[model samples]
Target: MANPADGTVCNGKLHNHQKQSNGSQSGNHKRNGIIRETQQNGKPYFYNKPFVESFEKVPMYLAIFTNLSYGIGTLFGYLRDFLRKHGIEKCNMAVERKEQNDFVPLYQDFENFYTRNIYMRIRDSWNRPICSVPGPTFDVMERVSDDYNWTFKFTGRIIQDVINVGSYNYLGFAEKSDESLTTVRNVLMKYGAGVCSSRQEMGHIDKHEELENLVAQFLGVEAAMVFGMGFATNSMNIPALVGKGCLILSDELNHASIVLGARLSKATIRTFKHNNMKNLEKLLREAVIYGQPRSRRAWKKILILVEGIFSMEGSIVRLPEIIALKKKYKAYLYMDEAHSIGSLGPRGQGVVDYFGLDPCDVDVLMGTFTKSFGAAGGYIAGRKDLVDYLRVHSYGAVYATSMSAPIAEQIIRSMKCLMGLDGTTNGMQRVRQLAQNTRYFRSRLNEMGFIIYGNQDSPVVPLLLCLPSKVAAFARILLKRKIGVVVVGFPATPLVAARARFCMSSSHTREMLDTVLKEVDEIGNNLSVKYSRHKKSACPELLDETSFELED
Candidate 1:
């Protein structure tokens, strides 16, 4: 995928993004020296080991490696170049100053500093919004019209469509359509588009209630409440549900919204290692025993928040294990299904259905409609009472604009189609095919000597490219080759593991994927980003590359 519409912007959003030692105060053994080599699971992972790791106080680690074949002076030069290039050192300096309150004087010429030394010298590679719709293949603009100009790059031509390996249109329902499109149209005819009021006031429509019912039914929940924006559905709702006396057990890789929501709740937030259930259990046990530091009393409530799928890592949640832990701890579970709903399981009811787990085992089930539903907004599904409480208490209901009736209708119709009430198995078939696409693409990519991430069931697949330049080069090369893929680096993922993320869709044909795979294989070798560092894997032998589908 070239771009993710629902890109979570969550590489350790509220939590610290750096990878630190598991414990505190290991002590500064050395500084301004050659970085000690690092190993992952006993083998060297070829990552940029830190030149100097700040020990004891600040807990900072700077990994700047440039050609170990060269000397220490070469290392320093690369460090300086990197600092200036990413504005990372500048950011750290600002933070250090901010900690001292009046340390940053009013006389600081911020604009002048950025223009003269920072912004002007930096690359303008990010935040380039596409004017065209993000579809399976869509037109991308080249420049602002001066007589007449619209250029699309790919296939060595101008103003032509490019095959998208970007965009999180998981089920290929992003475009405006037959039944779902008609539903939206009919809704527009009746509601005349925008409601133009808060959901608390006159904005609430019959379709809103109807849509909520469909979502609840689809996910096998008692009830569901929806908000106009997907991000707010969790961020705004978390505060209302969990408060100061509560504790939030969050996954380290949770989305920015989850992090923000935890902050808003004013709860004591403790993060567990991503998908590490043992670490989660340890944290829960500790929190349960110790409670808040000052009070030494038990927490008023405890909320275990996790995502159904980790977007950046391209990994699915260990829902069954997490559920067991939550039950043992007697804590409420909040599952953010933003990337998983309508893209998992036999019937696409999400992780719960995929694992055949009890739906009610989860206290709060959250998801965004943007990915799989091909609609806007988000839903929080749980018990009827929790939803009823949120209607009056949730700030989103009182302040935010209601989701347009048309949007709600579209979601309703889409859900009906998925549930097979639309007199067709089109949606179900799409789900199965999308899974096949994911397994086939991942299996083939892995076989081609590209180290891939995420569970086999997920559509989000990321290929690791160690350096930032390689990440940029990969996006550029793939675009020139007529395939679009989303590149993630530095703050979005960890500093080292920069990768190109390819999101699979049911609309992506076997031929299209084969073309993409071939182009990517060529580019990976040309850019020298393929599995040079990959240790011998026992898994690659398991993948059958002759066919496009995984063995049963």
Candidate 2:
């Protein structure tokens, strides 16, 4: 791996990347990266496309036939629906067989154990890929009740419509048919589909420039750089910013992408309790005193990583105190605003705006448009020098395709609407309605004896269903009642903290909220998951998980 901060690969090669002085940043720079290129061709590959490279040798006609056959097989996938609605499908978990005597029986038979005990019971509900647009309401293949089991019963249906509290489409923009989406349509006519190449490879478009400007303006930053995918925006950019000599102090509950990015950067990483300022301050003090973990040498840089809004917990970042600590400890702040941008704050700029904090207070500001903007990408906005540096050195910029022209337009138009600059208050209205919706939902759930996690203002409201089996039961029962709820157990969250999270939308009506609350209350009561006066847990769920969190 290369140390990007100093512009040199492991072999002492002088890469094209060069650092620019803040006062003299008009300089241009070139970016370069390499990937394992030659792809093995099977039947020369089942599909011989002009774009993808294959390494296997086979005739063209055979490849074409293979492609057609694969399509045919995929076309008949609906046939599986015929049998699955009746009997339980055996799961194919990733684990080795217990063939050899020396092979660890537990490890080798893990797949079989999971399939029999866990997956076979809940696999049907876990990964139900949707065919229709996701929104406040969407269509899903409804399972038919064929027989009764210990946990639940199978139904007599194949598909049905359900209310969606599962998606992150906070403003309903993805499913909107409003005048704002018309801007996306107009741009599509002019720009075709994709930009066809990475922005570094000459695919940068004018709309990309406008989108960056709007984002910078919205977030009160000096400049902004956009990328094609939201997840990669953080995963790739972190490596470009920090390297081995640096230290990263991360939130214990930060996103998986941030975790992967820190590991890739090879930085000495220390974790703080989630949103716990005291724990963070403690870690920061240690980093400043002892420096790198094993080396015990002076640190080159220290970056504090956190999310604007934690997705699973639905909690807001303590920005004010965190900002104070960052300055006190002389650490750079990296805030991933994926959940907060276009969702929180009166103006919808994100957590910084929500807290009325200075954008310059944080070092590297990150966010995604896929949430409230109803678009497809993310951006890193900060000082002009930081933006410029990332443009030439970030791996995503070096290899990933530029964000689509029309999708950029969608973001631009959405930002303009939020700012009330497009001759409409629709943007502000969406922001206001979402705020109202999230509050109302939380209050109702609280009133109904439900144990919910997250701050009062967050659109992501999670109901703590303590038992893993209750996660499956909550989701299964809710879906049968024509409500779509998102649930996650064990690996995603701690085993005891499994939850069914409800994501509120600006598009949800008062009636929709009422319907969800009523149904949720009844189901929670029936399942004995409700927290009544006589039935409170010995270990209260109100005890913030941060208190007992094990730092990494």
Candidate 3:
């Protein structure tokens, strides 16, 4: 049988070459165990008998036909390129002569051609306005403030000095402390900057080990392993723990890194509704039914993944309920406390600590030093065996270069300062101030008719604008007023859920909050957008109520 589409033999091994009318064989010939053909110049050509025999003996004739098709394709490609070059040159000359004031005719012709071809259609798919409007340009950020009031330089524009309401420095550690800088400088002098190698290849420094130990102790875990960066820690750790026959039950709103890690592991991943324990239970039951059973090697393990605090939504995970469900299913649990650590709990020990839950019960606790510690890198705290296993086997930790010595040292100092004797007192004070600021900002924003999301205690507050274009416009208005805030739209969140995300900080003063709320109120009124409040509170309130005082 032959394929009519490309002159390929479909069922048989031999290719049929039609004899020419000149009493000579034309095109390529195949007969018995030999291939003979006439060249374009009319010369006769012969192919090896063994080669012909082997080629003819192939079970699928489609391969030979494919090669013929490829040759024809190449010829067409060349002709197309040649024609395009000539056509484009001619078009350019014609347009230059006829269209000094307008390119309407040229544009119409392009549109016609673009719609007619599948490849062209796909190539121009991104040309449409998917988003509402363009975001604030660098040209708009021209102002630089000497005073530490909330102001960001956009473009070359000098906007007014607005209060800073959109920074993630929860404890105000970035501005108030020279401790991290001092530690980094000292470590750099002692260790000479970067370690310049992966952990497995002499990248391990004393400070790195010390910091890991400090993190483990702070989190109340048995052991800990550090990574060069936070993203790598989350992305690499998830894949290292689950693979093949294993099933991963992830929260739908888990960080992108966790999603990528689960994807790379090639595990059976089922996403429960965001923060919905019932959905999780349903998925777990289904997983048990479909998962591998019997032999230890064949039996699959179930891993539950969640974030301590969602970065975008500013919601806290219901750890107690989740733990109960995990225990019932005999599943492992992994928590990314990236945003929670140094921002939650009685002493800023994070969500697990806030609930007074036993650290041993939690299978894995991971956190980053970028936010609260005002440093870089990430760490995973777990049982000794797990940490040891990952240290040797984790792809990202093993292959990627380790954190620089100065960075590691700075993190160590920051951790020690955070967990020291006065740490509890200082941390509590910062948490209180942050809570006060958050409450004040939220209360004022709500009164002014602005919609807010996430837990009330959370520093992250999102002002919903709904339209992607409005989100960008709102950000520009805030920028013009000399306020720095981030506008999150499409891909980061759903198109319809576009918003302006504000990260409140303890470093912010009462006056700053007042000023920011005023601006927000004015903007909302001008835009005629109705605002609402959606606040959720966390449990196990701290006992030290008079630990700190808020600065005016």
Of the candidates shown, which would achieve the greatest TM-score relative to the real structure?
Answer: 1
lDDT assessment of candidate 2 = 0.71
Per-candidate RMSD vs. true structure?
Answer: 13.7, 18.2, 26.5
Candidate 3 has an lDDT of 0.63
Q: Residue 114: error of model 3 in Å?
A: 18
Winner by lDDT: 2
* Model 2 lDDT tens row, 239-357: 99999899999999999999999989998898998777789999889888998768899789999999998999888887767887887788899999999998876567687656544
Per-model CA lDDT versus the true structure:
0.71, 0.71, 0.63
Which pairs clash in model 1?
Answer: 1-165, 1-166, 1-486, 2-166, 152-159, 314-454
Over 4 Å off in model 1, which ranges?
A: 1-127, 143-158, 177-180, 532-552
When sorted by lDDT, best at the front, the candidate numbers are 2, 1, 3
lDDT of 3 at 511: 77
